[model samples]
Target: MTTVIEVQNLTKRYKDKRALDNVSLSLEEGAIYGLLGRNGAGKTTLMSILTAQNFASSGEVRVFGEQPYENARVLDRVCFVRESQKYPDDAYPRHAFKAASLFFRNWDQGLADQLIEQFQLPMKQTIKKLSRGQLSAVGVIIGLASRADLTFFDEPYLGLDAVARQIFYDRLLEDYAEHPRTIILSSHLIDEVANLIEKVIVIDNGRILLDDDTDAVRDRAVTVVGDAEKVDAWASGREVLHRESLGRVASITVLGGVSADERAEITASGLDLAPVSLQQLIVRLTQKAESATKVIAVKEGVR
Candidate 1:
C-alpha cells in the first residue's frame, strides 16, 4: 500500500515549551489509525498540523507526496472533522452541509441527508441551539458525506450518547466497507474505537510512545491471576505492566506474548491467564503524575 501521509522530525513549540517533540510517523493508505494520547499530550497539535490548519515550527509534512499547505490538489482530498469546528453563530445544520458540498470533491449529498435523518438532527435549528450530541451529529454527517481520500475525525463523538455514538461508528464502518479510505481518528474514547482502528499511534508527553498494528499491540501483553506470592514470583524480571491485588489473590500484567512453553509453565503452576483490555494497556503505558514543580510552587504560594 502507498504511504498517504508522512512526517519527519516534526516539532512544534509554543514559547519555551515544545508541544510536539521531534515526532516522525508514516500512514498507509486505506487504513484506520487511532491517534491517542493524554490531554495536553499534543494529539490536537499534531492533527492540526497534518490538516494544515496550523503551522509546524520545524518539520516535514507530506500528503500525497507533496506539501499540503495552500495546495488544493492535496487539500481537496482531505477532510478534518474536529470537536471545536467553528460555525457562524446563526448557522443551521443545512448551512454546514452546503459549505461542505462546496469544499469536498467527493461530497455526497444523499449520504449527508440519510445521516441527518438517522441521527434525527434538526435541519432548521441554529447550530448553537442543538445539544452537544446534535452538534456532533452535524460533524459526523459532514465527515461521512465528504468521503475524502483521507479523513481526520478528532473526537467527533464527544457529548454523543452511547446509542448515538454507536450509530456513528456503525455507519462509518458500513460506509467505509463500500468506499475504503484512510481514516485517522483522534479520541479519548479508545475502547469504543478499538475494534475499528487497524493501526494504533499512541502519543505521550509530545512524543510517539507506541505505533503498531492493533493485533500486535494486543499481543504485547497478557495478565495472570492467582496467589499473590506465586504471581509476583512468576512476574518478577518480566516486563510487568500493571498489577492489582485483593486479599491473597493478585493479578499481574506483563509485556510480550506468552510463548507456548511459558503458557504451559503458567498452567502447570495453576495460575490463570487472562486477556488484557486495550484501554488498560494504554492507560498503563501513558501514566503520568502531576508535575512536581507545580505542587511545590502551590505549597510555597499557600505558605
Candidate 2:
C-alpha cells in the first residue's frame, strides 16, 4: 500500500500539558483507520494538525509527501468533518454543500444529493437553527460526497440517534467499497466503529499506546467466562484487560489470543472463551494510567 501520511517524532504541548509526546505513525492509502483514545488523548490534536487546521508544537507531519498546511495540492485532496463544524449564522445546509463542491475537485454532487435525501436533511433551514443531529447529517454528507483522497472525521456523529448512526455507517461502508480512500475516524464510540475500521490507533495521555491492524489488536486479548476461581486462575500472570464478577461467575479478558491448544486447556478448565470488545480494551489501556494517578493522589493525601 502507498504511504499517504508519515508522522515522525510528533510532539505537542499546551503550557504544562503535553498534548502529544514523541508520537510517530504512518497512514496507508485506501484503508480505513480508527484514531481512538480518551477525550483528551490528543486524537483531535493529531487530526487538526494533519488536516492543516492546527499547528503542532513540535514534530513533522507529511501528507502526500508534502506538508499539508496551505499546500493547495495536498490540502485540496483532504476533507475534514469535525463533530461540531461551524458555518455562518445565516448559511443554510444548501450553502454549505455548495461551498464544499467548489473546494473538492473530486466532489460528486450526485452523491451529495443522495446523502442529503438519505439523511433527510432540511436544506432550506439555516445551519444554526437545525438540531444537533441535523447538523451532523450535513457534515456526514459533505465528508462522504467530497470523495477526498484522505478524509478525517473527528466524532462526526454527535447527537445522532442509533438509527441515524446506523444509516451513516451503512452508507459509509457502501460508498467506501465503491470508492476506496484513506479515512481516519476519531470517535469515542469505539465499539460501534470497530467492525468498520481496517486498523486501530490508540492514544492515551498524549502518547500513542497502541497501533495495529484491528484484527491483530483484537488478537492481543480474549474474553473468558466461567467459575470465578477458574477464571481468576486462568487470568493469573496474564494481562487482564477487564474483569467482572457476577455471583459465583466471572468474566475476565486477558491480553493475547488463544491457540487451539490453549483453547482446549481453557475448555478443560471449564472456562468459555468469548470475543473481546475493542472499546473495552482501549478503555482499560487508556484509563489505567489515570486510575494510577488517582491512586497516587489518594496515598499522598493519606500520608
Candidate 3:
C-alpha cells in the first residue's frame, strides 16, 4: 500500500486555542477512513489543513508526497467537500458540476447526471435557494462523481433524511468498490459510517485518541452485564470506560481485549459479555479522555 498523506507534528492554533495539538498521522491509498470526533474536536481543522484550505501554524503536511499548499499537482488530485460549501450566488447545481468536471480530470459526467436525477436536485434553482438537503446532495454528488485520487467529506449528510443518507452511503460503497481511492470522511454519526470505513481515527480535544483498523478498535473494549455485585467484583481494578446500573443489574465496559480463558471465566460466573459497537466505544473513549484531561488540569493547578 502506498502512503498517500503524511503529517508530522502538525499544529494549528487560533489565538490562544490550539485546534490541533502536535497531531501526526499517515493515511494509506485506496482506503476509507472515518475521522471521528465530537464538535470542536479539531476534525474540521485537521481536514482543512490537509486540503490546504487552511494554513497550519507549525509542522509539516504532505499529500501525494508533495506539499499541498498552492501545488497544482497535489490540489488537482484532491477534492474536499465541506459541510457548508460556498458557490456563486447565481450558480445552479449544474454549474457546480460543470466547474467540478473542468477541474477534476477523472470527473465522470455520467455519474454526476445520474446522481442529479436520483437526488432530484433542481437545476434551475440557484444554489442558495435549494433546501439544505438538496444543497448537501450537490456536495455529495461532486464528491463521489469527481473521482479524485483523494477526497474529504466533512459531514456530507447534514439535513439529509434517513433514506437519503442511506442512499448516499450505498452509492459511496458501490463507487468505492469499483474505483478504490483514498477517502477521509469526517462525520458525527459514527455508527452510520462504521461499516463503510476500513480504518478509524479518533480525535479528542485536539489530540489523537485512537488510530487503528476498525476490527482492532472493536476489540479494544468489552462490556460485562450481570448482577451489580458480581460485575463489580469481576471488574475491580480493571480500566472501566463506562458503567451503567439498573436495580440489581450493572453493565460495565472495560478497556482491553478478553482472552478465551477470561471469556470462559466470565460465562462461568453468570456474567454475559456484550460486544461494544463502534459508536459506543468512541463515545466512551472520548468521555474518558475528557475526564482524564480535567483531572490532569486540576493536578497541574495544585502544583
lDDT per residue (tens digit) for residues 1-303 in model 3: 899999999999999999999999999999999999998999999999999999999999999999999999999999999997999998988899999999999999999988888888899999989999999999999999999999999999999999889989999999999999999999989999999999999998899999999999999999999999999999999999999999999999999999999999999999999999999999999999999999999999999
Candidate 1 local lDDT, 239-286, one digit each (tens): 877888999999998888999999999999999999987887888777
Instruction: List residue ranges in candidate 1 displaced over 4 A.
Output: 288-303
Report how far residue 182 has shifted in candidate 3, in Å: 0.5
Q: Candidate 2 vs candidate 3: which has greater lDDT?
A: 3
Per-residue lDDT tens digits for candidate 2, residues 1-303, read: 799999999998899988999999999999999999878889998998998999998989999999999999999999999976889999999899999999999899999988888889988789999999999999999999999999999898998899899999998999999999999999889989999999999988888888999989887888999999988988899977678898999998878778999999999988898986888888887766678768999999999
Question: What are the per-model C-alpha RMSD values against the true structure?
Answer: 3.6, 2.2, 0.9
User: Scored by Cα lDDT, where does model 1 land?
Assistant: 0.91
What lDDT does candidate 1 reach at residue 284? 75
Give residue 144's lDDT in candidate 2 (0 to 100).
95
Clash count for candidate 2 is 1
State the number of backbone clashes in model 1. 0
Judged by whole-model lDDT over C-alpha atoms, candidate 2 comes out at: 0.91
Stretches of model 2 off by over 4 angstroms after superposition: 292-303
Cα displacement (angstroms), candidate 2, residue 60, comes to 0.9
TM-score-based ranking: 3, 1, 2
lDDT score for residue 241 of model 3: 98
- Write the number of the candidate with greater lDDT, choosing between 1 and 3: 3
Best by TM-score: 3
